[model samples]
Target chain A: MNGKYWVPAVISVALMLGACGSTKERNPAGGTVPTQTSEPYTDRIAPAPAPVDGSYDAAAAAERALSTNIIYFDFDDSTIKPEYQGVIDAFASYLNANPTARVRLEGHADERGTREYNVGLGERRANAVQSALLAKGVSAQQISVISYGEERPADPGHDEAAWAKNRRVQIIRQ
Target chain B: MKSIRYWTALLLLAAFPAAHAELEITVTGGAEAPLPIAIVPFSQVPDVQLDIAQVVENDLVRSGRFRALPRRDMLQRPNTPAQVDAATWRAQGIDNVVVGQVARSDTGYFARFFLIDSISGQQIMGYDVPARSIDQMRYVAHQIADLIYEKLLGQPGYFNTKIAYVSATGLSHQRTFQLIVADSDGENPRVVATSREPLMSPAWSPDRKQLAYVGYERGRSAVYLHTLATGEVKRLVSERGINGSPVFSPDGRYLALTLSFENNPDIYIIDLRSGTRRRLTDHYGIDTEPAWSPDGTKIAFTSDRGGQPQIYEIGIEGGDPRRLTFQGRQNLRPSYSPDGRSLVLVNLEGGRYRIGLLDLATGDMRLLSDGPLDESPSFAPGGAVVIYATQGARGAELATVSVDGRVRQSLRQASGDVREPAWSPLIR
Candidate 1:
């Protein structure tokens, strides 16, 4: 086009561009345009299944069910408490009944020690739990232990109450 | 006035920085307690913008040998060593005075500091270190403290050194892994590298020019050496399986690393100058955590080759390895003491993973640190203290403990969990 006509042609092209946008272009709201890089994610939240009305009559009849997962130790110590032997026994019975079950003993520590020391400490805590379980007729093959080593705390607040709860080995069933 | 001479001596003592520095000093081998010191204030810098003097005071106090003067108790702050009226400070019982001035520099500022004896006004130590920016001002302050600590204590200060650590924020599923470098106090944390996958194991080059670390990039693991002075990075090993735990030998000639090219992890030494590699271990079990001895002749590593993880020492040249740890059921991450006489290992004893110093001389091991889950003990170059990773709630973090088990302190920063603190070798 001639220089004088070029201006009008440019204006027409600009008008056309203003009217249409590429599919890859996005809105100003930070919402992504549909693109190959974008993966579709589900937005619908589903309710969990309704609970059955049946009761465990035999298990509910048992007196004072003990939580056998956690066991505490003294500072810098991995020795299992004598008073907690009954809980270990109950856990041992449950583990024996469920033969295919695998368990992970997680060890944790209070903030009193160094992190590496705690890793070792956590490992020892888990090791002690594993040994106790093995001593109670549980197969080593059925048990797997990982010392989170204070990496994962059961209670996270920085206080004695939190520490007391953290310094324990937890038996997790998998 | 009763006696101007008496008043003058008292006034001289009061004005001196050494007045607070006179507390009991514990020599490493001695049974004496650390000297109590009063680090009476250096004049506060209004625009200088950092608690510079306070940091010096804290370093001296934290060493366990110099008990620092509590800030609340200073009767008067004499501006300079010359103006220090020793008599008043002697009356208050502070033994030393530290004085400094921070002046603006081209980029940031220059800080000049001096330690002076309260009675004589004689300077014990003085230094002028440039802080390139406000970010480095804090580090420069620590450098000055190191000068003071070394002048007074004869031992090298760990303050000027940088600690390499792995910092992770966010939950486990959405976590970010970053290899970070910061002051030994964990200040001014900056990321060296970041990744969605785990970044583990950091080691310092003996020259302090570069840092070697494990990087998990693009579903592959490799060891990388990053130049701090030049911002250059090089990948040393990116083979199949695990390529991690790179440690530089004392002479800076070779790097001992753990690689799994053959479907198993074993210790391997690479000539940094030639890029040639030689395998150090040939066992079926795991052989990891290789730490070079101070003399660079032998490497101390953790191997389950003995049926359980134990500290073992093998010559750099191929030979039969000798196991160093026999007491612990499992011991990993064995770090050699700089003196070449001791190895600090993660000792699993009564169920706690405490830092244990194994005296190579006596073949005796004592669990030095208390609390739980302590692993990965790295020695301070002078073999005075240890810095290691321990479990904090939520994730792994770092804390330090002295060799004598007396001075234990955490790097009390609010940054997300930090782990694997490898102390850099002396830069100067």
Candidate 2:
């Protein structure tokens, strides 16, 4: 916590750390520093910049919720099982239907990774859903996301059946 | 008073070197050869009939830094400071020596002890502590180890503290959760709460007077704060969406929690004094497990802001968030060491969740816990150890590993499965 680290506290500074994701802003001792100032950050991973339609259609919006556990992933990920296009699509449509209605996406994990890592993973899952919904024409103003860090497991058991259920993205109303 | 004399000795020891006013954890660097030392039983008040010497020796050994000398090999056990013969231990290949005695008080008892450099024949450090002030003899022993640790390692010792964790045990087919508190060494487990439903996230207040955690009852999860003295409990957060993951700042002024009441799950800080809440993260993505650094300037939380469930750091008030973890395909539940210098996190490797420590400096990571499943890693306030949920032989149980992965112990009762283990701050 103290800014000075080169003295007697060398080992502890090394305890709570591991390698970081983006290495652009590395510290002198190699710790990563913050980049974006926004709260609900949406990483700009240029996918040819999807065209902005600026149109709202209730039926056309992505499915707001799904009874299934199928989610989608951008590349290689077991988190938020990516094929959730339908769920994202439904949420997009719901957002278009009611702009005033605020909805939140709760991200979750499969109990496979560290709980804290899964929290960020869950957040990433929720963020991915939010971004995907935005691409399908969902307004950012009405949607929010939070990661539970594997604290709220949909399935409490330790087996695979439970892990699949634990790795999820629940949509909640504000 | 003997205890007061020990306090003065501690103060003098602090003035010499290796004492910290603020509690700090001393993490051992990479796998180095362990240090060899000896702690000879100190003399005590006549007829007191308590030997806390072995207890002090045990704590130091658990640090993974010291190799304690067996009590049977001791050539002598001295009570008075002048009686300590550093040469005797040095001849036995012991590097350090500790000796002490006990004094009786109107209420209970008082004790004084010291650590010496056996090789140099120098008075490394010495202090006296009130045994009566310490209802638990283990804490008094921890103080002895802390003095020796400070004299040698120069970091704040966390031996004289406790950890709060949930223990579960039942029919292998049935599940239950029980909130239990025990010594850092996994001794004296006393249940504070019990139920068939699951209990998660055992967090300690800054003062260590209260604990905040989430419990499941009647099929719903709610956050509750339990007082150790009164056993009185109150709900801090319980809403329509999941309301959980409560962590306290160093100052114990506020608690950062995950709440879905605002539609999307966002991170919020609740004032324990007034019940006022402040929202810190607003991303459409999930943000949970907000851990405060020792200084309380920034919060290290698990967020997928980038696109994966990676770790990120955000300001307490609000501002830009910087990504922290990137090594494994999956990482989360980053708990800061007491000094906020390093983080103990659960990392997913080869399809297993293991405990790992991230050096805030160097961006390098090292695997600490070896297991198929690990979660909810909570750091000791000093950052020397971490307690988290793990899948043991039976079911879910609470396990601990020193930051260096040298010392490991698991706390399991007949309850059912222990999920979250939070280390309490030093208060008493």
Candidate 2 lDDT over B11-130, as tens digits, reads: 111111211111112233322566777766766665665468887776777677777788888898776557768778778888877777777777677667766777777776767676
* Global CA lDDT computed for model 1: 0.69
TM-score of chain A of each: 0.61, 0.55
* Candidate 1 chain A weakest ten by summed lDDT: A57-66
Clashes of each: 55, 68
Instruction: Give lDDT tens digits, candidate 2, residues A12-121.
Output: 33332322322332333334655554444445333232332323222222222433324533322434343566666666666677889877777777766654345456
lDDT of each: 0.69, 0.67
lDDT of 1 by residue, B115-219 (tens): 876666577777778877776777777888788777777888878777777776665556666677776665555566666655667888888888887665543
On lDDT, the candidate that comes out on top is: 1
Per-residue CA lDDT of candidate 1, range A1-174, in tens?
134444555665565554453323333335555344354543333333233322333233221233446898876577889977876776677677678978767677775544433544666677777788889899877876544445456665666688888889887767
